[model samples]
Each structure stands twice: as C-alpha cells, then as structure tokens.
Target chain A: MKKLFAMLTVIALMLGLLAGCASDPKPTKPAGTQGTQAPTGGSGGTAGSEGPSEDKAPIRVGVLAPLTGTMAEFGKTYEVAMSMAAEKVNAEGGINGHELVLEFEDSKGDQNQSAELASKFADDDGIVAILGDFSSGCAMAAAPICDEEEIVLFSPTASNAAFAASSKWAFQIAGLASYEGSYAATYEVGKYAGAHDVAVFYMNTDFGASIVENFRPAAEEAGMNIVFCEGYSDTETDFSALITKAQAANPDHVLIVDQTSISNVINQIRGIGWDVPITMLGPSTSQQVIDLCGENCEDILTTVSVYYSEEDPEAYAFAQEFADRAGFGATVMAGFAYDGVIILSEAIAACGDNITRAAIRDNLAKTDGTYLTGPIKFSEDGDIIRSYLICQIVDGKYVIRCGYDYANE
Target chain B: MSKIKAFVGKHRSLMLTAALVFAIVFPLFGFKKSMVRIFCRILMYFTLAGSLNITNGYSGQTSLGHAGFYCIGAYVMAILTTRFQISFWPVLLLSGIGAAVAGLIISVPTLRLKGIYLSIITLGASEVIRIIALNWEGVTGGSFGIKDIPRPTFFGFTFDSPLKFYYLFLGVAVIFLLISYRLIHSRVGRSWMSIRENELAAKSLGVRTAPAKMMNFAYGAFWAGIIGGIYAVYVQYIDSAVFSLDEGFNIMSMIIIGGQGTLIGPIVGSIVVNGLTELLRPIGVWRFVMYAALIIVMMWFRPQGLMGESNSILAGAKIKMRKAGKTGGKKEAIS
Candidate 1:
C-alpha cells in the first residue's frame, strides 16, 4: 500500500516537472510591465506593436531585478519604472528606429540566481545590454558573468565602492559609498561647525563599513566628536539599547548609515525620547524610509540624487508620471532605474547606428552634464560622479534643503 | 533479437561500459554555456543533498543547519585562497575538514539532545555562522563577500569556464557518491541504520551509538563542505546571503523530494529540483509556488518519497541476479 502511494506521488511530480520543463522559454509578461498608463504625450497609441516599423526587429534589453524575494516590492516598482522608461524611448523612435524591448528576468535577490540570469542574458545574442540586479552583492556576483561575456551590466542601485572598479563591463548609477560618505561628513556634519556632538550608528555590513571608513576620517577632519559610534548587525531591530547608549553619551545629533532598517533605528531613537537632528546617508534618501518612520522621519537630512521636488521640467514629468503609474511616490530606486534607461539610450545613441557593447560602454563613460541628476559622467572608476542634493523630510514629503551645488558656509 | 539478447547476456559488462560512455558524453552534445553552468549547479546540489542524506535521511536526525557546514567550507575556501594565496585542490580537502570540525562541535548537542531541541541548536548554529560571516569583516569580507577567489586549476590550466568546472565537479560528485556508497554498504553503515531502526536494540547489540552518530554527522558535513568549496569556485563569489537557512531547507527538500535514503535518490532529486528551478524561470515569482506545490502533492501521495523504499526500481535498487536467486526481492542490491 505504501509502495503504491509512493509510486503515485512520483508519477505526479514527474508529470509536473516534465510539464514545467517543456513549457519552452517564451517571454511571459513581466508582473509590473503591462498595458497601463496608455503611452502618454510622446506617441499616443502608435506604440511599436502595430507600426510601419514592424518589419524592424525590436532591440532587446534585459532587466535583471529582484522581481521576487525580500526586495520584491522594490523590484516590481523597478519593473514598472523600466517599462515606463522603455515606453518613453520607444515613443521617441527608440535607438536608430529599432524599438527597445525589455526582457524581464527575476534575480530573486540571490547571488547565484543573479549570476545565472546574467549568463542566460549574455548567452542570448539578441540581448544588447543588461540593466540592474538591485543590490550591490547581486550586481557584483553578476558582474563576472557579464565581464566574461563582454556585455554591459549597468546597475541602477548597487552602491559598493569595490564593484565600480571590479569589471570594465560594469557601471553603477548609484553613488559610491566613499564619495557619498565623505560628502555627508564634510558638508552635512560640518554645517554645524564646532561642538559636533554626533552619535554615529552604522550597519556592520560592507556597505555600511565602507561608508564608516570614509565618514570617520572626514568626521575627524571636520572636528566632529563622534561621541557614540555603534556597528549593529543587519537583523538588529530593537535599537533601544543602542539608543540608550547614544542618549547616555549626550549626543545632540545622530548619523545613520544603513539600508532598509534605518527607519526602525530612527523610530526607536525617537521613541526612547532622544530626539535630535538626524543625518542619513545613501539609501535612506527614499520615501519608503519616510513612510515607515512616519512622524519620526521628519527633519532627517539626507544626501539624495532623486529629489521629487527638483526644479527641473524633465525630472518633474518623469517623477509625476512614474508616481501616478506606480501608485507610489518615486523613490531613489525608481528614479535611478528611470535614469538608467535614459543613460543607456544616450550611450546607445552615441554608438551612432553601429551599436556594440564596447561602443555603448565607451559612450557611457563620456556621459557629460545632467541627464536627470546634476552634472553626470563616469569617473576613472565605472561609478558615476554627480553631486547630490541635500534634502529633508518636511510635513510628510521630501523637501530639498539645498541644490547639488550647495556649498557649506 | 533472441540471438542478440543471448549475445548481450554473454557480454553484458561490455554493453554496460558502452552505456556508461554514452551517458557521460551525451550532455556535451547539447551543451549551451548557460546549460553547462546550470548543470554545474545541479551537480553541486546533488553532492550537498547526498551528504545531508547521510545524517538526516539515514540516521533520522533532522538538522536544519546543514548550510552552516556549507558556509564553513565556502568561507574557509574564500579566506584561505584570497588571504593566504592557497590553490583550490588542497583548499577543497581543507574546507571539508573545516566543516567536519564544525560538525564535531554540533554533534555534541545533537547526540545528547532530543528531537526538536537538536533542530533548534542546528538552526541557531547556522544563523550564528551567517551572522559571523556578516560581522567578521577582517576575514569573510563582511557583506561585500570574499571577491575574486581564483578558479580551480589542473596542473597549470585554469578551470575558469562553466563547462570546465562542471566536468571537474561532476567527477568530484561521482567520487563523493562512490565514497557514500562504500560507507553505506560497510559495517559502520549497517550500524547507522540499526541506530535509526531502534537505538535501544542497536545499543544492546554492542553498537556504540554516540561515536557512530558523531561519525555520521562528520561524514555528512565533510561532503557538504567539499560541495560548498566547489560552489564557491564555480560561482566565483559568495557571501553570507548565499547560505541562508532557506538554502539549508532547499537542500533538505531536494533529498526529501528525490527519495531520502537511497544512493541515486539525491542525484535524481537534485537534478529535478534544480532543473525545475531553471525551467520555471518564465513564471518569475510563481516558480517557487509551483516547486512547493509539486513537493506537497508528491508528499501527500507518497510519504516515502519518489524512491524511498529499498526495492523501488526508480530508486536505483540494483538487480543482483547471481547470489539472491530468481526471487531476489528482500535482499536488495546497491545501484
């Protein structure tokens, strides 16, 4: 009886496995990339599908993002953002008359998965360039694959300083931790001049450590006495002990260098009745952090590249349209993803009809002046060199306190 | 056809050799670089799952911290190679030994404790290792991970490509399988099974359960460590995120879904689970859903797994026609 039951189960699983394996790899409609927000302004309804240029093959660009796993929500928004950007490109006659078609592959926020997808995307000769794999770890993991295959891996959100210099094929739109970390210390902390009673709380991960590496030197140079400095694990949620320690140190200001869980630390710090002016670096420049921390999120100064209230017509249109389409205000992730498409297009355009990965990368390095955020260009390292706007959460939204060119008094 | 069968019966060993050659060379014919890469991973899981089966399946010890040992092997490989400039071959064995040392530490509680408590200890150990990998920035590279560890080399030639790594690890996986086969069929293997069947009876029969179980844990962890080292080189990069508890469960699932205790079971299980993972790519997030559903439906129908029972044919139950006679039913042959 047990043997029979086991046989039946084996047969059932075998059938499912066979069926799943046999379903030939066709492009399934990616979750968030769909028929929403009818192609506005650029080319209303003459979308590439039923066009005279139907004979021209669509130029395929692969998007490797966390469409699943812990970063799924951000990944989905990135998909929507990428789709929006692609549509805008397609509406603008795309690159040399071939419409840009994005092939969405889920990295599942895993290193192995990201690497696998990178190889898969690279293997497909039709796929011209690859954009993103969200986190720096995923991006770095995928970088070797792209490097070996000689393809572009333009990461929109990977923020590791090591990754930029790792591979020639890799390019990061996200600010390097070194520059942003030092910039935060010199400008943000130095703005208070003397009596710098800062309590620095950093995540003990590589990303946070890299920031701390630069922040400490810059802090000392600016004569900021870091009274309470603590390196907490990534899974640390209850910051009550850390907060009490910071409070006991009698700090009048706080510096949070973290990702995602910064909100929890901020809310707990405020909850422990240790209210003070806060300075957050890098990824904290998001509306998600603001929404999560609620009232405690206000007056938190952040060095940001994706300010929604930027006084630029193009930035406003993209942000407004993206927010309306994605059902949430544009975060730095969405903004960079949107900008990544623009950067790719500019690079592809710079290739001037004979588009190749090498040409695209070469053109990418020559990206001079504002594409969306400040004066943008690639440094000697593949990282983008752009000054960030200093912003604060006022009321319930992001309010830019100073422009990218804002100098310390 | 009757004459052919008679001739084949006379030269069955030669036919088996030809079949083995065909089986080995078949994948190379359709080898896309991506497919080769995928197969390398499939082989990795195969090796890992088989090791887990040594303790989890054979001894009935549910260890939720299998990936912890995997982490040890990987981190050892990562640290030694990048920091000390050690080559891959020696590091492979060192990693296995490193993980075995970790297994020895865990076996103390695992042997003394009962059921769920043992599982909790293991789970705790796995998480602690991951946390260490995250915080121990000096050696493990913190969360940035140990980047650009050199690829495995043969003489002076680098096993840098996926196809090269696939063949290298495929041989290693087969060797592991062979070692496991020998271990399972040995007197020690019989003792492990006896312990699982009835610890009191096995103890009464002069079996030292403590030492045997400890050996079993170390043996299992040794395989996991080797595979983890291979995985580190194959992917060329690894971090704490690579060996989360989910991966521990994932390896456990492959053995469970494939047919827990049998020799060929894990090999088959790893192939199917990892293959399904790749095949279900178009489904995006729903891939895991489909995978879980298949496993659930399979378990509901057959609690013994796909090839769990000893005499099951798909379980690779070898047909030894010689010694066991015409009714070679009860005394199952090893595949």
Candidate 2:
C-alpha cells in the first residue's frame, strides 16, 4: 500500500512538473542586427540613424535583485515597475531611439550572488549603468565594482550610511541610516509615559550597528539618556530574554532594528506586556509584519521610504497600481524599487540616444523632477536628496505622520 | 554475439571520444552569447560540484563550508591582482594554496564531528569568515569589497572577452575534473570508501584515518580556492558577504542533487537545478519552496542520489542486471 501511494505521488509530481514547463512563455530572443536596426538610433557609422551621432554604443543598464528566494515578491514588483517604464518609454521612443533594455539577474538575497552578478554584468553584459540591489550589504558589495568599471550605479533602497559613504558609484534613493536614526532619536521619548528615558534592542549586524552609532549621538545631543542598549541576532526567534532585560531597564521608550521575521519579535515583546512606545528601523512595520503581529502592530511607530497616503495624485496612483498588482499587498521596498526604475527610465529618456555611462551619471546628477515618492535629486555621490517619513500604524496601516530630512541642508 | 560484445568492451574509449567531440563542437556552432553564459555557469558549478564530490560524495563527509573556501580563493586572487598588481597566472596558484590552508584549519575541528554537528561547525566557520571580511576594513575593504582584479594575460596574450573567459574557465575546470577523477580512482579514493563504509575496519586496516580525512578536506578546499580565484579574475570584484553560509549551502546542494561521487553528477545537477530555478523564477517566491521540496523528495526515495559512488556504465549495468534477475522484470535506464 505504501509503495502504491509513493508511485501515485511520483506520478502527480511528474504531471505538475510537466504543467509548469508547458506554462513558461519562452523568453523573446533578440533579433539579428538587421532586425534591431528598424527605428533604432543607427550607429553613427550609418546614415539616417535615429540616435545621436556618437561613436559609442547605446548604454546597457543592468538590474540585480532577489528575483527568487525569500525576497522574490519584492523583486518581482520592482521588475514590473521597471518593465512598465521601459515599455512606455520604448513605445514613445527610447532615448533618441537608441533604446534602453534592462537586463535582470537574481541575486537570491545572497551577497556572493550579488557580487557574482555584478562582476558578470561588468564583464559580459557591457552594462553602462546599474540600478538595484535591495539590501544595503548587497549594494555595498557591488558598488566598488561599479566604481572600477566606471559604470553609474544607483541603489533604490539600501539605507546604510556606511555603505553609501564607502564608494563613489553608490547613489542611494533611500534615506541614510543616520537619517533614520536621527528621526527616531528626535522623537519625544517620554511622550506616552511622561518620562524621557529610552531603551534600545537592535540586531547585531551592520544595519543595527549603524543605527546605534547614529542614534546614540543624536539622543545624547537631545539631552535624553539611552537607559539600556542591547543587541540580538536576526536568527533568534524568542526575544523573551532580551525583552526581560529591556523591561528591567524600565525606560519610557524603546528602539529596535531588525530586518528579518520581525513579527515574532513584536509578538514576543507584546506578550511580555511591555507597553512603552516602540520605534523600529529597516524592514519593519510592513503589512506582513502586521499580519504576523495582529493587534500587536497597532500604534507602532516605524520609518519607510514613501508616504502613499499623501495627496499627490501621481504618487497615489502609482501606489494604488502597485497595491492592486500585489493584490493590494505591497511592501515599502517594492514601492522604492518601482520608483527607482521610473526615475532611471526618465533619466535615460532625458539623456537621449548618445547615452553613455557618463551621460547616465550626469542625468542622475541633475534630476529635479518629482517621482512617486517626491522631488528626487542626487548628490555628487548618487544618494537621493529626500527626507524619510515617520509613520504610525493606526487601524493596521502605516499612516505617514511627519517628514524628517536627514541631509540636514 | 559474445565475441561482438567482447570487442565492444575492448574499445569503450569510443564513447569517451564521442562525448569529448560533442562537448567541444556544441558551444561553438549553435549557442549564442547568452546561451554561452548559461553554459559557462554550468561548467563553473560543475567544477564546484567536482570539488564537493571529493569531500562529501566520495568520502561520505558533509561540508557546508565549501563556498567559504571559494570566497577565500576569490579574495586572495583579487588582492594579489589588484592591490599587489600581480599577474593572474601566479595569483591563481596562490589562491589555491591559500584555500587549501584554510580548509586544513577548518577540517581539524570538524573532522571529529559528523552529520548535523559537522554541518553546523562549517556553517559557523563560514559565517565567521564572512563577518571578518565585512568588519576587517583594512585588508578586506569591508562591504565595498576589492575591485578591478585584472583579467588574465599570458605570454603576450590578453584574454579580455567573455568568449575568452569562458574558454579559460572551461580549460581550468577540465583540468580540475581530470585531477579529481584520477584521485577518486587511486588508492586514496579506496581509503575514503573504506572509511565511509566502515570506519572501525578502515582504522584496523591502517588507513591513518585523520590524515586521510584531512587530505580529503584539503584537496576539496584547494580546488574550491582555485575556482574562486579564477572567479575573482573573471568578475574583477571581491565581497566578503559573497562567501556567506548561503553560498556554501548552494554548492553543497548542487553536489547532493547532482550525482555526488561521480563526474557527470555535478554537470547534470547544475543544469537541472539551476536551469529549473531560472525557469521557475516567474512563479517567484514559491520556486524556492519547490526546490526545497525537490531536495526533500529526492532524499526520501533515492538516498544515494541521482548518481551514486560508482560512476561507470558498467557499475550501473551490474546493478540493473542484478535487480532484473531478482525481480524477473525488464530493466530500464533513464538519463
């Protein structure tokens, strides 16, 4: 009977495999040189070309993200946004008709894979620009490659200040780690309990470490003492021990920095019945986090890249479209990634067909228009000049309460 | 009929010759540039799997730290090429040596443990290396990584293009595979099998178990390092996080799912698993779940894996004939 059941299972699996193979729409192959020539900005050597008369070729832009594995959902949303922009621009006519084709590789959320893809893009793809790498670490690893290759790379969502500060090619769309830290630090620590003391629990990784480095300085300057500062690994599921430590400290407010599976930590903290105001950084307070925390997520404070609830029609529409595509379930990083592609495409269109790595770099440098998030401009190092929004969860949604500009300009 | 069979057996080299000819000609005539990259990935993984095969497949030891060695090799090559401005040929050799030494160190503590314990130790070791890579800002460049590791230049010849790199990787992979194949067929391989099958008996046979085990670890580490160094030169960048525990898991999985302990296993595994991964990516997140399920299922049924220790057709034939005789049924082989 067991053998029979196993045979049946095998048959079922085989059928499923066959169905999957049959469903994939074969990737469209690039036609030969002659086919590509139609409406193409012709190479300068050719007459009556659509593109500018530059000796160089059309710039290739490479996009790397976690196309598969844990971060696949976020990656797909970004790909969709990028595809839409690429399609809309190419339809209206690409940069001086030279055309911009965005190539993608799955980093699988592994730093090694990201580095490998970065190297491959630099070596094989002849890419002139790069836009992606969702995590700060991944982007940090790839930035030097871009600098070496002289490729213009703009990261959409990596928030680590140390990462951005390390390389010249790394321009980030997300606010700096220091920006998030200051935003949290400047908040009235004792507003809820009428006390000015705060406690901190953070992941032991660089993301967590950077927040502490920045937040402590700002908090001290604001005349508030950090009553307790503790760290934990992202892999630990139970926060009971850490929560007890924080509760013992008996501070008026608490700060946490965790990027993976934060729902458990939230629940554990709540289970301990500690009701002090909480502020967390990086990949916290998403819909998924709320789903995992349920009522525990209510009134929780967090920071993210966009404020979709704002009145800007374009931003609202973009958010609505993304929410609709994600079945009304989109993460903040997805929004940032979507806008990043749009910004990149817009810059490419601005550059026209004479697009080189240098041109793309220049286009990004001079960006003045507002994207879905807000007015976007790049500093010399490629970081977006925008403020982060402090949001609170009311009725299980991140409500943008205020904006904090971390650039301090 | 017996004489014909004997003649065929006597000249089995024909099959190998045909396979070699096909491998050489196939990429040149029909495959495009993109296809060539995919094929190159297949070869790279194959070389990686070959290294894993020696440690895990042939020796029956599970290592979750192979990618750590790979990273060590890559960083060494990158530092030598870019910071020291050394040539690729010398740098490549140094990378292998460096990785071999690291493997020796990792294996010493790990050789006493087995199964999950060994896996955890290797995983921890790899993670420790990665953290050091991230935090050691002076030499490792922290997260920014080392960049512009020079491409190969040999005897007035510069290999600058993808096609050139592909050939270079292929040549090096083939050499490593040949070395691996010879090692597996040698007395050392028999010692590994003896230890794997019966450790107590092998010890009684004067196998010098610790040295044998360490040698297996060192050799695996050596080749992984060489492959990694080549990768740095190929990609021209080095990041510490790239050598994390996740990479180690992936290479181990490739070896496991492919036929561990066999030449064709890694090659077949890389294509089947990596290709399916890319193909299923449109489904997005569920693809990983599917892959994990596949590994689980394969383990449940064919614990020996797609290709077992004995790589030859003769070994397979021997098994099939025995099973057929016992069951009194038709024998079938699937590729």
Clashes of each: 0, 4
Candidate 2 TM-score on chain B:
0.87
TM-score of chain B of 1: 0.88
State the lDDT of candidate 1 residue by residue for A300-403, as single tens digits: 88888666665677878888887777677777778788778878877887787688888888888787757665556788878975577787779978777777
Ten-residue segment with the worst summed lDDT in candidate 2 chain A?
A36-45
Instruction: Give the alpha carbon lDDT tens digit for every residue of B1-335 in model 2.
Output: 34643676577579657766766676675443334555566677778877877787767777887888888888888877877888888888889999899989988987778778987887887787777776665787665567656778989888765466678778887798778767777888778766766678989989988888899999998889899988887656566756767777778787676666677678766766666654564454567788899789766654445554322232345544654675575321211
Candidate maximizing DockQ: 1
Model 1, residue B78: distance off in Å is: 1.2
TM-score of chain B of each: 0.88, 0.87
Q: What is the TM-score of candidate 2?
A: 0.73
Question: Can you write out model 1's per-residue Cα lDDT over B1-335, one digit (the tens) per residue?
Answer: 34654797689779767855754685676555776777678788888998998887777677889999999999999888888989889999999999999998899767977568988998999999988998887788887898887788878899888878877877887788778888889988888877766678989999999999999999999989998888888777788888899999999898888777687678778877887887667555567788889788766654446666544332332322321464456553333
Estimate, for each residue in A127-173, the C-alpha lDDT of model 2 and write its tens digit.
Answer: 66788887776776676666656666677878766555656666787
Candidate 1 yields a Cα-based lDDT of 0.78
TM-score of candidate 1 relative to the true fold = 0.90
lDDT of 1 at A169: 88
Off by over 4 Å in 1: A1-52, A192-195, B1-23, B310-329, B332-335
